[model samples]
Target: MDAETLEIRTIEVTPNAAGDASTLPDLLAQVPADERITRVGGDGAYDTSKCRAAIAARGADAVIPMRRGGQPWTTDAPGVDARNETLRAMKRLGRTIWKEWSGYHRRSLIETKMRCFKLLGERVASRSFDRQITELKVRAAVLNCFSQIATPHTIRVA
Candidate 1:
């Protein structure tokens, strides 16, 4: 989703056994080839080579943070060198500052969307797989509409 607009761009429904890292490549594929994405942000859970590679393959900066006690990448993978550079920055500038510099904080925008989804309802009412997906899509659409309608109009007071 766009950070400013909160408009969803990709939706992938994977089985429980598949971790987020595994589904990332598929999710990234949903982005239009012509679109120029600047950054892809995720929590520490996505701080793996596969996820990083998927982001780098799309020519976007990975805003994911390394986990505690995380080691710098030693391989020549797509995003490993950049990850190592980020690790060094984290070491020198500290985690908080590095996160700020890297725009990792934007990850919370998705979290806010999740929170709104939960607020609508935690459990899917539909029993069938296709129906459940449809339900989720409908919910996402509603939330997006609500977000648009609720956006404040700034009136400058002299």
Candidate 2:
């Protein structure tokens, strides 16, 4: 989701067998290479090495929270530094303060968008997987249109 527009920029529908975190890389890949991604925010489920690496590859800060009782990655990997720093900060400032400082609460915007998407329908009407993917994409487009329409316009008077 694009934070500024609150629109789904990329959509990938996977089978029920696939984990949500596993799709993070593909979603990032779908983004145009030239586009500048400043930050990627997600839940603790996205705290995996692969997800972190993908976000780092895009030159974006990962706003994913560490898992409960999670330890620092043992390997001196490329992405571990940022995760370790987050861990240290979380330990020092406490989770609530760290989250506020990191702007992690922006994740709630994504959650609200999902709730609006669910309002369209809880389940896809299509029976086949291919059709289901198309259905979901169409729904996302509708939501994006709704977002564009609902956005308020303002002007400077002074």
Candidate 3:
């Protein structure tokens, strides 16, 4: 998702049991190559080396939290190394403060969309895989339209 625009740039529908870390590469691949991505923020599940590598390849910072006792991968990717440094700083600054400083809270934009989806309908109306995919795409489009119309734009003079 584009944090600034609050737009869903990519969506990968995976099975319920699929690990987020394992699916990072597929999701990252969906991001357009031309897009200028500065940082990729995710929850602790995305702190693995593969995800870090993909983020580094895009020349972006991985604003993901390390798991408990999670050590940095021994590699030369600057972004990965920077993530490790962030882990160290997290220990000093505390996770909550670090999240505030790093703009991790913006991740809630996607969460808000999820909430909207749930509010609109909790269950998939279509049972078939292909039909379900089409249904979700249409639902996302409808949600985006609703968001565009309902979201108030405010200009800050400060």
Q: What would the per-residue lDDT of candidate 3 be over residues 129-157, giving only the tens digit for each residue?
A: 78886787777777777877887899999
lDDT on C-alpha atoms for all candidate structures: 0.86, 0.93, 0.80
Q: Sort by TM-score, best first.
A: 2, 1, 3
Q: What is the per-residue lDDT of model 2 for residues 1-158, given as tens digits with 9 covering 90 to 100? A: 99888999999899889998999999999999999999999999999999998998899999988999979888866679999999999999999999999999998988999999999999999999999999999999999999999999899899
TM values, all candidates: 0.90, 0.97, 0.87
Q: Which of the two, 2 or 3, has more TM-score?
A: 2
Highest TM-score against the true fold, candidate: 2
Of 1 and 2, the candidate ranking higher by TM-score: 2
The positional error of residue 143 in candidate 3, measured at the CA in angstroms, is: 1.1
**lDDT of model number 1:** 0.86
For candidate 1, write residues 18-108 as lDDT tens digits: 7887888888898999998888888888898899998998999888888999898778889998888888899999999998898878878
lDDT of 1 at 101: 90
Best by lDDT: 2
lDDT assessment of candidate 2: 0.93
